[model samples]
Target: MSTVVYLDRISKAYEKKIAVKDLSLQIDSGVMFGLLGPNGAGKTSSIRMMIGITMPDSGTVNLFGQPFTRESLKRVGYLPEERGLYKKMKVMDQLVFMGELRGLDPAVAGRRAHDWCERLQILDAVQKKTEELSKGMQQKIQFIATLLHDPELIIMDEPFSGLDPVNATLLQDTLIDLKKAGKAILFSTHRMDQVEKLCDAICLINGGQAVLAGGMREIKSRYERNRVLLNFEGDNSFLQHPAIADYKDYGGQAEIQLKPHANAQDLLREAVQKATIYKFELVEPSLEEIFIRTVGEKVDA
Candidate 1:
């Protein structure tokens, strides 16, 4: 796959604060890359630099494998966190207008807008004024607008912010399909669960620097599968086994955290002897657990 976006040691700062520091990552075609962080973790700052909304103080930004240029931006589509729709305009008109700004002919823009609205199950809202729609509907409109011109690189910041579960899942499926069609998608979100499910690779930022970055499986592999979930019918005394570090018991079930390099097999053997073990499974650290461990704080998500 071709590299769609590249940031080489990019750094940016305001008068006194560094917004991003020596951050670097690349997104390749047909890949879904998540730029994750807490609020004010420089995710937005890094995105702005990627799309030329703001210039970096040091290092380079490359698009489609060449130096950044206005021409390159035509191949990019950006959906910012904040909504920017013209509230009075009809949905179709607004989407067509956005497509035109991206160099699509008016007729082609109108056609694509209608097709996308139909595909997204929002055809009935095409003639509705933007301000008349609900927040989720408006968000979907913005999403459609972002893709109307068929850009190769799609950047979305908190794209699922106001969406309901069903709509969010719809958009998620859409993004997966886009990735399959060879679009390079870069989304910044606080939703680790969503990232774990959708992203092929990720760059997690904290305090203006990457705290964890890699393919999902590779990153998860770095941490131990020291957590265990148990279900039993009898004695809960086995929870005190030497291999266990800490655990929470809820009557017949327990969620356990093992001590570093603890032997899970020993704990399982003990658990079985004390109780009729219905289930005993050792699990890897979840993405959220790794995030908190790396960032040293709970995620707002």
Candidate 2:
């Protein structure tokens, strides 16, 4: 339950533009935290500061409950969205080098490199040059490099990028296993739905500021569950009811977002009269919906 990474009142600006403004967030041991934002929202900038890739103009970064320093980074694993590998180097050699850079000895680094490739099902590619491997395989290599030194805090930016479903799921399971092992994990990704299922807490940034931040359940609870999902095979006249704010009808299915202070039970009664309801359920706003709503509102303002 100890804090693993903390950023207090961090601010970063590039020339005339601000990248992060008074941003603050914390991650605790055994927790998976999501850093979310639309393009140019400062998620990447904030993450860079967390790992000391760039210093914030003003603010503090504490890693592993201590003041930020290069030594602390040895206990922190980072995989940036932009992957780097020696094109001419063999997969195993490249991995070993990356491991050593993170403080492993040559023998230990090579051993861990081979072990990870086998566990990740990429052992065959060990002898091949990094340039010859597919993007997905190279990504797996980078993932191994991140864990080479057995870091306690893992930070990944777009970890699932360019991966097939099977490989993506493989990485997801690995991250979950790490969390169970008491490592604090932070990830920034555009895949909101996946984050919704995987992250325990989230900080949503817009225009370099955190517009929403909290435990997932607490944040979702603040929003009204006035959305209705209807599965019917007949007339869809209920979608036009006065209580319905907006709706999307796809043949036998309809997704309805109710107006403010709208009564869903009243709308359901009307829906039953027009269509033979096969399934009717009211559900909370998904993370995706909330992301759009919050970011859209910020943009409009």
**Best-performing candidate as measured by TM-score:** 2
- lDDT tens digits, residues 1-301, model 1? 9999999999999999999999999999999999988789999999999999899999999999999998999999899998899999999999989999989999999999999998889999999999999999999999999998899999999999999999999999999999999999999988989999999999999889988899999999998999999899999999988888899999999999999999999998888889999999999998888888888853432
lDDT of 2 by residue, 1-301 (tens): 8999999999999999999999999999999999999999999999999988899999999998888999998798999999998999998888888888887899999998888888899998999998898999989999999999989999999999989999999999999999999999999999998899899999999999999999999999999998988899888877889998899899999899999889899988988888899999999999999999999999999
Model 2 has an lDDT value of: 0.93
TM-score of each: 0.95, 0.96
Worst 10 residues of 2 by lDDT: 94-103
Clashes of each: 0, 0
